[model samples]
Target: MPGPKSNLIDLEILDGMPDGIALVRVDGSIIHMNAALRHMCGVPDEPGEPLKLESLAVPDNIAQWRRFFTHAAEDGGPMSFDATISRASDKFTFYAEVSFHRKSLHGEPVIVATIRNMSRHRKIEEALRLEESRLEALLRLNQMTGEPINRICDFALEEAVRLTGSRIGYLAFYDEEQEKLTMHAWSAQGVKECRISNRTIEYPIKNTGLWGEAVRQRRPVITNDYNAPSPYKKGLPPGHVRLERHMNVPIMDDGRIVVVAGVGNKPEPYDIRDVRELVLLMEGMWRLLQRKQSEDQLKMSLAEKEVLLKEIHHRVKNNLQIVSSLISLQSEVATPENMTAAFKESQDRIRSMAMIHERLYRARDLAKVDFGEYLRNLTSYLKSSYQPRTAEVQIDVQNIMLDIDRAIPCGLIVNELVSNAFKYAFPDGRRGTLEISMRKDENGILLVVADDGPGLPPGIDVSNTPTLGLQLVHALVGQLDGELALHREKGARFEIRFK
Candidate 1:
C-alpha cells in the first residue's frame, strides 16, 4: 500500500516535466506514463494500470522504433530514433531520444524510458525553409531591376509577375493632377506588352480603389481573391477585366511620392517582400528621370543664349558699316576749308558711334561701357588735331562706367567741349590745363570740363554764343533732356546736370 500524499507527489513530478516520459518493464509492457506522454500520444485519460507498449508505437517508423527499444531493453543503453506515430487515427512526426536504464528499487529491476514531442521543432524548420525561399526571390527581383530607369522599369514589370507567380500583370502610374491611373507597362506569360500606353486606361485615383488606397496610406495593399466580397476588394474599371489577385504600393523618392505602381492578376496574394523590392527599383528609376529633365532644360537655355548673342553681333556690325559709309560719302563733296572741317566733324561723329559699338561687341559684358577707357580714346583722337606746341594743355580724366544709351551722348559732349577749349581758350600760344571729371551726386550725374586758359571774352553770353561749337554743345545738352551751365573763372567751366 502507498500513502496518498506519496502518490500525489509522484504524479506532480510527472505533470511538471517539460518532455514526455514513460516507463516500461523488461518484458516490453507499459509500466507508467507521464501527463506529457499521455497528451502527446492522444490518450486523454490517465492509465489505471500497466498496458501493452505496442499501443504507442509510431506506425511509419515502427520497425526502427521497435529495434531501438528492443536493443535498449536487452543492453540497458540509450538509443535515438525519428518516427511518425498514429494516435486516434492521426499521424504526427517526431524526433525521439529514448534511454533505457535498469533501476534497482528494493532489489527489483525496472527500465525507465523518456520520450519527447518533436512536432513543434519540425514546424520551425519548415518555416525557416519557406522564409529562405522568399528572401531568395527578393534578391533575384533586385538584381534583375537595378540597371537604370528604362531597363529597371522593364525588369520591374517582368519581375512583378515572376515573383508573384502571376500569369498576367499590369504596372500603372497615378497622375494625381489628372485624377487618372495611366498604365505604364504589363507582362503576361513569357512576353511583355512593351506598349504599356496602349493597354493603359484612365481611372480615378480616389480613396476607394486599390491603387488610391496604397498611395493615400503610403503602403502596400494586397488582395488574394479579387472576386470575393472583402474590405480589400474594390471595384475595378472596365479594362481591368482579368485581375484576380492584386497589389499596389506607393513609390517614394526622398519621402515624396511621384508615382504608384499596381500589379494585378497574380496567381497568389503579393507580400511585403515584393513591395519593398519594387520601391527600391523605382527609387533609381525616378531619380534618373528627374536628372534627364533637368539636363534637357539646361541645354535649351544654352542654345537660346547662343542664338541671342549671334543676333546682337549681326545687328551691331550692319549698323556700324552703314554709318561709316554715310560719313565717308558726306566728306567727299565739300570745298577745301569746309571739306576739311566737314570731314573732321563727320569723322568725330562716326568715331563716337563706332566707340559705342566697339565697347559693346568687344566687352565680355555687353550691358555697359567703360567710361574712362572710352573718354581716353576719344580725347586722344581729338588731341591729335591740335598742335602740341600751340598750347601747353593737360587733360585729366576720371575712370567710370556707363551704359551705351547714356554713354554715346556723354562721349560726344566731351569731344565737342574739348575741341572748343583747344580752338578758342588756348588760341595764340597760351598754355592751359583742361580738367575733365565725372562724379555722381545725390540728385544726378555731373559732367565737368574746365580749362585753365583765358576767361570767356568780355560781354560774350554763352547762352547766345554765335560760335557753331558752343551752339552744338547747347543743342546736344538739350537733347540729353538735362540742364547745362557755363562758368568763367581763370578760364571756362562747363557743367551739365543730367536730372
Candidate 2:
C-alpha cells in the first residue's frame, strides 16, 4: 500500500541533485522514485511502476531487502545501508549506499531514501590496495640485506610475478656494453613447468626477438598479443613456456641497462604501472648485487693480508732459532776472557736481529724498516754494553731506510762495527768520538763507520780477518752484494757501499 496523497514528497529538487531519491511506506512499498532512483533500479517513474521495492531485488536478495526495509521503517528516524541494485537496462549492477529518513510531507509521514553508487569508490579502494601491496613487496625485497644475490633475485622475481598478476617471471642480468644477458633467476613455479633443457641460455640482445626489444629500444616493452606476426618475433624454442601476454622492463644504471625484469602470461594485459613496479624491484636488486660484490672483494683482500702476516711470522721464527743456535755455540768457548767476549758478541748479534723483527711487528707497513732508527738503537745498546769505561763516547749517525731483506744484513754489520769501536777504540780512560754516516751516492748507499782513537795494524788482510766481528762485517757486506773498503786516514774507518 502506497502512502496517502498528502504524504507525497517534493522530489523535483532532488532529481537534479545527482543522487537516487525514493519515498517508501512502512509496509515495504514504494510511494515515489525520482528520475535518478528510477534509472538506478531498472524501474520507470511512470504509471504502473512497481509499488514494492522487493520487486527490484534479485531473487537471492529479495528476502534480504524485505527485512531491510521493515527494520528501516521501524527505526523511522534515519538509517543507511549498503546495497547492489540492478541497472535499468538489466545489463549490469551498481553498488550503492542507501539511506532513508522519516519526514512529514504536507500532513502524513513517509520514508525518504538517497542512493549513491559506490562502484567507483570501491574501485579506487581496490587500486589503493594494489599499490600498497606493490610498495610492500619492494620493502620486503629491500629488507633482505646480507642474503645471497641469487636468493634475493629469486624473491624479487616471485614478487614481480605476483604483484603484476602474472603466472611466471624472470630476472636476467645484462651486460650493457655487450648487449647480452644470462637468465639468472626465474619464478620457482615458472622454472618447474618449463620444458627447456638448457637452463644456461645466454642470449645476445641482437639475436633475441620480442622479449629483447626492451633492451633494444631501451624502454619497457609490452606484448599483449604474443602470437601476432611481427618482424622482431623469434619462434620459441621447444619446452619454453608459452606466452599469451608478456612485459619486460629494463633497469638502467648510469644510463645503461643493467638488468631486464620480465613477466609473462598475465591473465590481464600489462600496463605502464607494471613497468614502473618491475623497474623499482630490479633496480633494488642491482644495488644488492653491487653491495655483495664489494663485500666479497674486501673479504678477499683481508684473506691475502692474513696470508702475508703468517709468512712474516714464519720467517721471524726461523731466523730467531738460528740466533739461538749461535748463542748456544758461544756457551762452549774455553777461556774466561774469550768466553766473555764471545758471549757478548753473540748477544749483540741476537739483539740486532731481534730489533729488526720488533720493528717489523710494530710497524704500520711491514715491508720496510727505518734504518736510521735501527742504527741509533744499536749504538745506544753498544755504549750501554761497555759501561764503567766512560759515558763520554759520542755517536753520530745518518737517517736511512731499507726493506727487511737488506735491513737485516745492514743491522748485523752495524752491530759488529759499532761494538768493536766502543770496546777497543778509546784506551787508558781516553774519551773519543765514533762517527757513523750513511748517504745515497751515484754508486749506491755509502755507509761509513770511523773512530779517531786508533788505526788497524798495517799489512793485515782485513778480508780474511780471523776475528768474529770483522768476519761478520765482511760476510754481511757480501750478503748485501756490495764492496767493502778500509780507510786508514786519521783513524780506522770502514766504507760499505751497496745498491
Quick one: how many clashes does candidate 1 have?
0
Off by over 4 Å in 2: 1-9, 22-113, 192-200, 227-229, 238-242, 312-499
The TM-score, computed over Cα atoms with residue i paired to residue i, of candidate 2 is 0.53
Question: Taking the tens digit of each residue's C-alpha lDDT, what string does model 1 give over 314-395?
Answer: 7678657646655655545566768777777667766776877787668755657888778777777777866545555455
Clashes per model (N, Cα, C within 3 A):
0, 1
Tens digit of per-residue lDDT, candidate 2, span 63-143: 677666666677776777777776656647767787767776666567777888899998798679878987787777777
lDDT of each: 0.65, 0.78
User: Highest TM-score among the candidates is held by which one?
Assistant: 2
Question: What pairs collide in candidate 1?
Answer: none
Q: lDDT at 472 for candidate 2?
A: 70
C-alpha lDDT of residue 27 in model 1: 71
